[model samples]
Target: MQSTAKAGPSHESVVTNGNGNGGAKSTPPTQRTALILYGSETGNAADLAAELASLTTRLHFRTTCQDLDSVSLRDLLKPTLIIFVVSTTGQGEFPQNARLFWRRLCSSALKAASLRKVRFVSFGLGDSSYPRYNVAHRMLCARMLQLGAGEVFERGEGNEQHPEGHSAGFREWIVGLREKIMQSFPLAEGVTPIADDVFLEPEWKLELATTDGTNGVMEGNVLPLRVANGHKSEPSSAAFSSKLDGTTGVVPNEDILPVKGAFTARLLSNKRLTAPDHFQDVRLLDLQLEEPYDYYPGAVAVVYPKNFPADVQDFIDLMKWQNFADKPLNVISTASKQLSPSPLRHLDLTHTHLTLRWLLENVLDIMSIPRRSFFASLAHFVGTATEDEAYQRERLLELANPELIDELWDYTTRPKRTILEVMMDFTMLKIPFEYVLTVLPMIKGRQFSIASGGAQRLDEGGSSMRVELLVAIADPPSPIIKYRRRYGVCTRYISSLQPGQQITIGLQPGYLDVKAEEMSVPILMIGPGTGVAPMRSMIHQRLAWARSMGLRTAGKRLEGDVLLFGCRSESADYFFKDEWHDLVEREGLTVWTAFSRPQTSTNAGVAGATDGDRTATRKQYVQDKIHEHASRVHEMLVKQNGKVYVCGSSGNMPKSVREAIADVFVECGASMAREQAEAYVDVMERDGRYKQETW
Candidate 1:
């Protein structure tokens, strides 16, 4: 018998049942297929989905993983085991990648019983600090249930503030998920559970080819490729020839190239936006792109930073791998396990031969705070022969224990220490190279808001290119080590870069949901500090719009644009001060300034404030300003139907601003009670009139 299985929404593969004959065969039945879909903004949900796919594949199930946006509504009607890994973004909104899917799911045309035959499960990544924590996943589960889908297991919510971290909670949830899957789908005859001892199985084989002393010709014929299971093979040239003029050294094969999601960019300029004497260091950076990229006003630029050379060298010296650091080591899977459906397939290092130094410098995040599992793994390497080793081992084990999690946080997280420092402090533990790969997290990029308007002319030829960013240097106050100041990995690296220095950056879009046509409505922008990045872009865009429409300014008394900006003091940290003045004078834009720390008489004309600006004497905050203008704000919202946009610190600013807006409704007689006023504000958020991007 023959059966068709769906590997993904866009993929289908054929599976044969027993032998092609009617007679009973000794082969076990084909594994049931499973679908894993994810919606992610910062790639956390996608990472968790990939891990779940890997785990399920090892447990004798055919698995396929894809983004939720790729799955159509028709795919939801299929009778399959589906798992959703999704994350909530600002204000409990669905991630940009998942918006289309969510809209389709909420369609009125779809019947309530459309997915009655489907069985599904879900997991959410969220931060408990937010008011609408995990609302995205909760909404997803509710909609799925409304469509008559049967949930096989309880939905899992992974909180970032959890004692064991989101990853540990996800790991625990997967165990229960596997058991539920087994009970829901019975195994075929003669099928057996996989052994717990089997940790890794390889799918592809790699072999090193020697280069001849002459041209690029090899001494012997290239080895024939080994095909695993029934996987198809791509044809390749038997004799490799040099594409270069043969003057330069051998070029590495495409397989050994850096992993995807990386783009090389050159630094064009770096200018400090804040005064030299200011407490904070804010900078404006211009990056020259090697290739053309497109982004909107509020999109982010993710910069993949490298560890400091000194730090990398320190880690290598601590590992005592100086001799073997540059050695070419070929990796192949152990021959004991079956090669079909490869395990460890997600790791690129398994398919190529690379130096240990390259992996340490580019692959692993050795400076990040070590997780609980890392401590547990480190405990195994601590020798019990000496008294120090015994005590350290016991302590490491305690730190790894779930019961003593608070102590673990105090020792590792509170001090903001890195794994290298922990290893140096331990003194007796020596982790092996093989175990290092398993414990360390992958080094990822740091995201910053794109501060400039997209696509600027790079030359006289009118070739529009380059992107700009606003980055604030983060120098932690308390030193992790005595006399050694700790800097933010990405920010410090970018700050240290000189003009014409090359770096890798990637564009992340969809942060701004507003379209160009939506600029007709009145906009109220409230942003403080570097949060003004996106607001600046919006202001420039509005200026262009006004020029196009032949209007002198963006908005009038109640119909145009208004911006509320705040900082410590105008003179020291007044970002884009000249530009704001030009915009207010030429474009008829309305602006309000709040200086939190106004200068006193003794400190007049210092960094805090100057005599020219009278507003600096009041010492007011942005939230206080909002409350002071409650009547005008109410008029803009209720009488003019204006939109509100807030960008700034996530800690108390957003909550404070939200409460201040709610107070406006009550003071303006729009609502009788405070709860009703808050409800009105919530309604405005639901209608997309109130938007925020804070972090």
Candidate 2:
């Protein structure tokens, strides 16, 4: 978690066409090397670049894995082959490094015929769940072609769900790239050939002795422990009052259980952000962290969330565990060999010195639905029920589908079914954590946009950074008993904290270039609802930096900042409105507010505002506003060397805005829909004109 890598060089230096000493272009020193340029937000693309670099070195190709911002267009064009591995940030925007790189690439000078010798291949990574899946890679690939770069092979595009997981797809792609590279560029002397058949699996294992007795039976891969009455809601404590169900449970004091090292922080303040009339609950969290924690303006912090104690207790009751809390048991692991070691053991069912409740919440996923194999393992239990084959088939079908299983588990069948019930149903088997892990996505941290500048200060001692975080306290509509809409894990934790309560958190380094020193740089921020966290931070940084420079926040021709903020109702959810006014009045800021719900034809409200005799219209969504200012945005990005930043939901708003921009390009003129849209976004990206951070 503690990163020691030096901060990268200035963005201008990497994108500059000519050195200050001479008007002549400064070509890179490593002419024979290949540059692996990665535009990654979550480090996956970077990891892929590192893997490729390690493999390419064996091919005698001196390679360097670089962030896109570290190299200029000259360096890119000079490389024999530049591998662009990029993932699309929110709203189809480029990742931080790629944004800067793309902006510069789109500059008139770089796009001219003077540099048409670039040869490149791209591999884009994205999830299929989103509509614009792999859109970033498509954009980069098109830009390379438009700028006269030759392609060595078909672009490699990998989805989140690839080949029963990633290993197979990754191995295949790397092998293909290796073969293509070998075929294109003859092997130099003394270069060794890599083995064609390398098994791609994590290299680690653990051995533990199995426990015996009526406590539990070590079935196939999982241990089947006994349970009382089989009701999930019955607390493990109550179930064990008369008889031992043979399982154990543990309760944690604080919400967070530090796994690795936790990032310590001081929760400066917390206030209810939403109105009392609103059904949803939200909060404005202000925290101050120590210095040397540099972050970009539009970056997200990944927070690890813990399950509620009530839910943990429910899992315990079903397992029928006891007070074996501090007892010792073997912990195992089964991760791939080439990867870094995971926090927990692999294959071992028994965890050491940890309570049953602790294991269910912090370790095992208790909410995981029973898999098909699990029912198959419990086949013997079916003997107690009716022997009708139709009944068995119905039960099997129910286990396979989550929707059906949830209905039965919540309403008709109920949590009364335990491991013993499984014995009465189908097969009895031991379930591996790996198989279980797949049932639910990793419990990831909610990424909030860093709104303040890293270079700002609060009290003389603490560094000031603004974060615009969404605190969603609404429950989802689900048929499953457990899936009932409840306050989100992190949101409720944040909402419940008192002003004086010190909260612990980690500062994930920012990716966008919103440093304190760059206060004079023009920035255009678009954030709807709570997505404005990082934008607030960036604006705050700019204000603080401007104050330090003894410069007025506004009036002078200082770098202009524009904010396009959207919400449901201006009255109920206009978050940070007063603070925004203070920023504009004290520091010369401009804000554009969009209220979609209230201003709709169905619910008209709010008066129009006038600026220099020009009256602004009633509210609309952010995407419509973006189109209205499309000409200005094009000018800002293409001419004035400004940056465009977006932060918001992972759903519709961002997607619409991107599509609107793509339509603007089509209106002007471009080849295919995908190509032109890609080119335009790529232009903004390569030149540092765009940055996006969203959940």
Candidate 3:
């Protein structure tokens, strides 16, 4: 829908971008505004919220959409319609982007009447497999209600395991929401809501400076270059440092990272885990913290990764944004909402002169797979004049259509097609430089489980502590684009690093909540592929506990710590295989392995192979091993109340593992029904006896 609201100020008048020209925001205020705040980890919740925001705009309401942390508590006090779409993250914790907002909401100073004028509704995205499922959505709703916000409709919950997935539930929820909006706040007579096919105006508007020779694409020195190891190094100093006031000057690298409490670390080791012929390349990275830092078992390190310089330049050239590449442009939020902690974020964007090249190279996520909202936005950029253009634009619109979700997934998500790849596919598509922020997603940090800590983490010199990460490089061939590959942007950045290279990393608390004091309780760990990282950390932590408990001589197996590790081949992807024998004999650790594809040359690598290990015949998976060791699992879980932790990729493995555990409960329990077995597993999850830290 075309906005009838009068422009309040020039683009330059608002925006307190660190640039010398920016000042306090001076745009129009909210009137009949619909605030849609989302908290997402995997971008699903944010994408859904963005889609709803566009729909709300089409319904003739002023819409403001952003992440939960971006807006202040005062914004919630506004007398307006509010909608929250939040995704539950690790355990029951709020997503990292939404933690600050959750903390603020928990303030004792907030009165019950603070949100008296706010009418709101909530939608949750979660997995039913989790005990504290949908906690993020539930917590927000309950808190808002306590603050006197009126509920306009019952909350809608989206389960990831639903037959059609979370998006299916959102499809149904949005349909009901549209009806509620019409009933609650009817549009004025003779004014109609925008058609479903129409595209809303971009929330962000960029104003270009006068076009001149100097403003066009600057060659070579657009970015500073330095040599390392007798070759040109990647932009490290100024790439992370942007002069927001638009100056091409270097600033102190003190605040190189946007996240608070981040520390610099140097790469000490980057060793490949898999064989050279392996389809996937896995690396075991050891990083030495330049400053002292502490993290517990299952803790994660969030690394901020940059795009490959060549890819960034390719994106600029592809868009024909040469003239605007080096030119500094002014950005203004045309809407009430300004993204702060989202992909469309305010981290380094504000501090720089805001050149197109700078945005691509340092800020934007050009390699991320475009969500459905991206296609909807892309539909606005291309024209439909010629037959070829019409077909391309029509297809983009089709992908954006709410009814064609399956088609959209088939075209984009399943193929893992990146934004740059999408643009390349549509030969006629060229988005305006001003709309780049709105079209492109921001470069978010990648989290890898800290694989090293405890005894191994501390150097023998007692001078340095190291944190390790097991990163599986993603560079698989694309199904749709046969000629191109799907190289993960963050993984690519990580793969290129050399020893002694410095980088900033953020630390995250783990959900396992394991304590060193729990020395008597046994623990069951199931880790496959790179998921073994966390399990490795826990083992190191257990070793430290053994030393502190004065049981070092016979301590490793004192608590009966068991790790059920799985991989495809013993000599190919079996991470940490060499250490198993030493751990079994010296540490008293029990290790079980499942090799889906065994090597023809030798047996599966179990240092002290038991009868069960020797008898394995055909291909086997982790879940199969769990079932084979059902009695032991039942003993540790039910009889002893030991904690069981599952760490792996999200797809079908977690669900299968949960089922295998439940099956064990059924087998062990006296006359236990299937329902009773499932219920018992649920209880274990509720009691925190069972925990999963999957992607």
TM-score (all chains, Cα) for each model = 0.74, 0.57, 0.82
**Which candidate tops TM-score?**
3
Off by over 4 Å in 3: 1-30, 69-77, 99-117, 128-132, 142-150, 157-168, 194-203, 207-261, 333-353, 384-388, 551-559, 600-603, 609-615, 670-674
626 Cα displacement, candidate 2 (Å): 2.7
* Best of the two (1, 3) by lDDT: 3
Go through the candidates in order and give the clash count of each: 1, 57, 6
lDDT of 1 by residue, 1-695 (tens): 11111122111122211111101222233435567889987768877786666555544555557778878987665424688999988778887679999999999998999878777899999876455778999999999999998898899989876765576567567778887766666555666554322232222222332222111233222222222233422211111212322322221111222435556677789999898999888989988777767666677888766555456667778877665655443334323322122222333332333445555555567877776656755665666778998899888878876557577878877677788788788877666554445445666667887777622314235464577788889877653465556667677666666677677677777455656665667788898888888888777766655566555533432236777888898678878877766666655566776778865433322121112233246677788878877777888887888888888776677788888898888898644589998888888888888888776
Worst-scoring 10-residue span by lDDT in model 1: 1-10
Per-residue lDDT of model 3, residues 1-695, tens digit only: 12212233322222222211101222122234567899987677887887777776666555668888888988876534678999998778888779999999999998889877778888999987665789888998999999987888789999887755787778777888888877776655665666654544465645554343123333111221111233421223335544332221232232244444676888888889899998888998888887877788888888888766556767878887765576655554454434332333435333344456656765679988776678877776666678987898889888877678788778777788888888888887778676677678878778899998578788778798788899999787767778666777778777777677777787777677778866677889999989899998898888887887775566344347788898997878989877766777677788888888875534555766331245444688889988988998888888888888999887688889989998998898788889998998888888777889887
User: Taking the tens digit of each residue's C-alpha lDDT, what string does model 2 give over 1-695?
Assistant: 11111233211211222211111232232223467889977556765675665455445444556778878877765556668888876656677557888888777765445346666677888754344578888987887777777787788877664522322345457668877877666544553443211111112221222333123232223222222233212222222323211212222234334444345455567777889988666776666653345555555555545544545554444333333322223223332112222324221222122334445545443433333323432231222234564466456546533234354444323333333234333332222222223222223344565545534434445544434344555433444335233334455445545444434455555556555544545777888888777677777666656666776634432346777788887678877777765655554566777777653343222222101123234657988766777766555554556777777675566667667666655544434466766687767766556666555
Please estimate how well model 2 matches the true structure, expressed as its whole-model Cα lDDT: 0.52
Error of 2 at 420 (Å): 17
Error of 2 at 413 (Å): 19
Please report the candidate that would top lDDT against the real structure. Answer: 3
Instruction: Put the candidates in TM-score order, highest first.
Output: 3, 1, 2
| RMSD (CA, Å), each prediction | 9.6, 15.0, 8.0
Report the error of model 1 at residue 231, Å: 28
Write down the TM-score for model 3.
Answer: 0.82
